[model samples]
Target: MFRTPLAAALLFATPAAAQQLTPAEITRVDAIVADALASTQVPSASIAIVRDGRIVYARAYGDQGPGMKATSADAKYQIASISKQFTAAALLLLEDEGKLSLDDKVSKWVPDITGADRITVRQLLSHTAGIQDYWPQDYDFAAMEKPVTPQQILDRWAKKPLDFEPGTAWQYSNTGYVVAGMIIEKASGMKLLDYLQKKILKPLGMQAMDQDYAVGPGFPQGTHRFALGPVRPAKPAAHGWLWAAGELAMSAGDLAKWDIARIDRKILSPEDWAAQETEVKLADGSGTRYGLGVSLGQHDGTPMVEHGGEAVGFLSENVVLPEKRFAVVALVNADFGGAPGEITQGITEIFYPPMTTQPAQTIDQARDALARKLFDQLRSGTLDRALLTEDANYYFTPQASADYRDSLAPLGEPVRFAALGKPRLRGGFVNRNYEIVYQGKRLVAITYAEPGAAGKFEQFLVQPR
Candidate 1:
């Protein structure tokens, strides 16, 4: 039978002003990760938790390879997108040294690309440059097998038309970072990797960080598991064009050390750090929750600065609770099965328990019953117009509902429909996850609502599991 993981109040003592990880906290952290490994079938992972600028707990779980056991002392994995923070930091360091300015136009360094005159270094860092993403949402997986140089990548995509006007909208673009890396080489008169090694990694004593995949020593292999069984070897991917964008390998503890440096101001100055943390706003003053390479959000009512990374076979998450002086980093050698946010949030809740008013248990029956009714109506090509919000109504029209039903038709009718986990509040919106079983296959349904008598549904989605 399925069970809610955090069903009861598994609380820890309030974090002391001095902040130390208790033995009890360490056991809980181990159990949380062990459970995740078992459920996801990921062979191994590395976890590190830092508090008050020091690593209090760091460990490796499972076997690293065919016969070798994974150990925290030496294991390293590709950190994927988390490398963006380093790229952003390098640019800021250059700015501090008066080698380059954030406001400098893209044309100042690499002028062959599109919109070079309008895009700035700061815009590239924040992903508002409007340059077409080199690896977009519809990125091709076959392209991974081919090696690419940074300039080759730019030549392929940079001269294309802008997706939108610079600073008008935000779009995540690996191309922006690639171009930024080129600018770094031009301004510093050194290779990007060499500059990083001399100016940042060596100074911070990050001895394990490396970018060359071919000459680099072997570490851990990434795996993929499609079902509940043994995982298969995923192709060893090279960073290729993702050099300064998402190409770095290091241990979780080392990553934690580098992150804690940010909080302690060991590298960038106070003003530069502030600029890194502050969100960039659009032309209309609407906020974009991204600052430089970091994503800004709130967790447990506390401010969180974080970034997640994903390459072909590795997934990484590094999060910092600046106000709490806490940070957690997790690196998993699995394609996408690892739940980094859940892992990080599990650690966060140990220090700060849920304080939001959970929707009363009495209302669950009503909510699920309504969901079933809506589900049936949607499958039968009709919709309860009163049940949907204006936005939902506009998006989930009869035609759209029919298309959705057709999408699920291949699965046959659902054999079971049950709530997957406890309903919780996120950013003031109450959301729930449910499992729908059909002919031995499982699919997921997510629904969100507004929480009172005016608690109408704002969004709903269904997808194959």
Candidate 2:
């Protein structure tokens, strides 16, 4: 899904050498979002960055489409399995209270489930329990009716089959998390949502969050969709079944607060936070991979903790780098395309840039002036595609180029880019072309065909180039 890797890469030298990122670093951060906004058809998105127990950046962009195309520092996104860390944290809080044991079997909490008699609480949090994800569409819908309750999920789904004998292997299973959420409920004698709101959300100052799925009324943005294609009335996930898999929403503002709170140990004990950071090993023990719901990896040389979310029309990622004292969160409203967790990781490299950089335009004044003039004409469509036509010398990264072609394939068309001369476009959506030109060391124009409207050749490029 990574069409192109960023030119900006972070070289983690040492924790002691780390400090807040610079202005240049911030430019890279915004550029990553800009590229995604143009390439992906996302209508709206929110991003937040927190560092050293502080919210350094919290921003939003794009229109809400049917609503207002606006960015909100207070906009809340339904962060899917990225919710697992909190789910695990909730369970651990109970463990600290002596109400449950990390090693306790699921049978103790939900005694009705026969298959879960041996799945331990820690195994559920670590996703080591052999359980199947219920939402995969392969299940017979005729037999499955209506939304399920917390206990119903354990009894109906958890009893299906283990992905492996307990702790023998690892397969991401939403079923394990449902069990963890149940443990929280039974141990606390509070509904999972109520307990989380009281202990986690409120304490962290995250007031605008909710996992509630249409309780007695309709929502302004519609209930969460289970799928995002050309499908009708996108399937809304069963409320209780969501459990710890997904269903939490919070504004970028609130998330920034929560990120700082984690650093402060405001909601979780130090020992529990340490355990959450412990690297979870793979089944065959080849790699110490996942920890609770988070992925542990390296960028340059810095250790990273991060997770992504997917629910109906929403796609998102939240990342944390304790060593760097930095974190980034991105949430998109539409979720048809691939939105990998690494996207945020990639953006982070730019937000907190390293010394050794890769770019054509450095910190220069003249280049910036030229770039602005060139982009202004191109964006306004006053210039034509003739100035920046495709050249044999210029080739995109192979994957990015291929993706462009694939997307165009739906329209069964080829776009001809900027051409030479006065910049007139030719052909239709099915067959079109353009050209890009640099006139005598000056930026010129780019002209491409307009698919639907024929005989109307748009020409925007008109510069000294």
Candidate 3:
């Protein structure tokens, strides 16, 4: 998602040498994972770290089940939505063989799907198809407890009116991917999992990965309701419910193998890789910061391509820093809140320390004043377009403006509004983060300004703390 070509090239360049973690560093990582398991009371977690195309750390902590064998590095955990990347890879491979194109209309394969004629395979891959998401809740509810075919899912969800016109906005819809998976089956003349196994998994030697339905009765089961008290077994969604969206399971070690392959560009061509990594743009020409199945962002100014997954009882996180040839994978057997993601961030800090922030007093007085004014304008729903860039204006659509006003007005004026840290340069724009507190609640605002004496706000985004 880096705006400039030079910045993108620098971030995605190949690594030079392998740097193994020191013994002390390994110990620190061990402590971090152990503490998370203890504090969160999650049953078990498997972790793997890859540096310079090699696995430097692979370990598991805690028990697999009550009084059962302890979890091992090879133990499988349902990876949920992380499976979308594999589904995406399957389609890309088909495209490479001239069997299909990402631009093909969905109606070509799934002709009955509502709005299928207008939606492209590319939009479905990037979550811009405007289809309503069938599975939005975190847990497997009553309807998911029973088996249902992919066609049933599409009939129930995709046949309805679209959430918006195709590609005008970005909204995550598992239903769209389910449609894409059907297309893969039609184009490749093979089952979805069979195609993935033959084309990608087996070639990469990822033997540990398998579809959840194919696994035998001996496979480890995850638990839910553990967050509240004692562990309770989670009821996984029926076999076909997850389909192409989130049905695969694998160990952290196996996931790391896939990460290494991605770093080396093993499976897809350079052009395909670029297409997979590039952020999809909205109709208004603003970036969605999502490419295919992965979420795109930066951590401490380092580019990151990553994804997280949640099932009835499993939670997983996978992150890769292509520039540094570093990646981290964390998988937990319990659905306790965000333990895998938190553990990934904690371990990442061991390699990349956070940037130091300047004191609030050191912030430019004019910028601070302008930020406060913009905060008020956002709450009042009366933004001054002259102070904003064209992109920023596009971002503040009527619905978005009403959303900001409705959400922020209730909090009233902020008790505190100040710069979060030193402003940084990105894409030829000065980017700054600010902390805004209303009553006792906190919110963060990120602004990108065009450089000038009277800099216009190129972007202003607000999210709750």
Global lDDT scores for all candidate models: 0.72, 0.55, 0.76
Clash count, one per candidate? 1, 45, 0
Model 3 spans > 4 angstroms off: 1-20, 66-68, 208-211, 214-217, 356-465
Best by lDDT: 3
Report the candidate with higher lDDT, 1 versus 3. Answer: 3
Q: Output the number of the TM-score-best candidate.
A: 1
Query: Against the true structure, what is each candidate's TM-score?
Result: 0.74, 0.66, 0.73
RMSD of each: 10.0, 15.9, 12.7
Q: Candidate 1 on 2-118: residue-level lDDT in tens?
A: 112122112211121222567798778867776666555566677788887788777777544442332343467888789998889889999988999999999999899999999
Model 2 over residues 258-358: C-alpha lDDT tens digits? 66766676788878887887886655775546777677776556777778776655667887877777777877655433333434756776656555533
Badly placed stretches (over 4 Å) of model 1 are 1-20, 67-70, 137-140, 211-217, 227-230, 357-465
Rank order (by TM-score, best first): 1, 3, 2
Please tell me which model should have the higher lDDT, number 2 or number 3.
Answer: 3
Cα error, residue 78 of model 1, in Å, equals 0.5
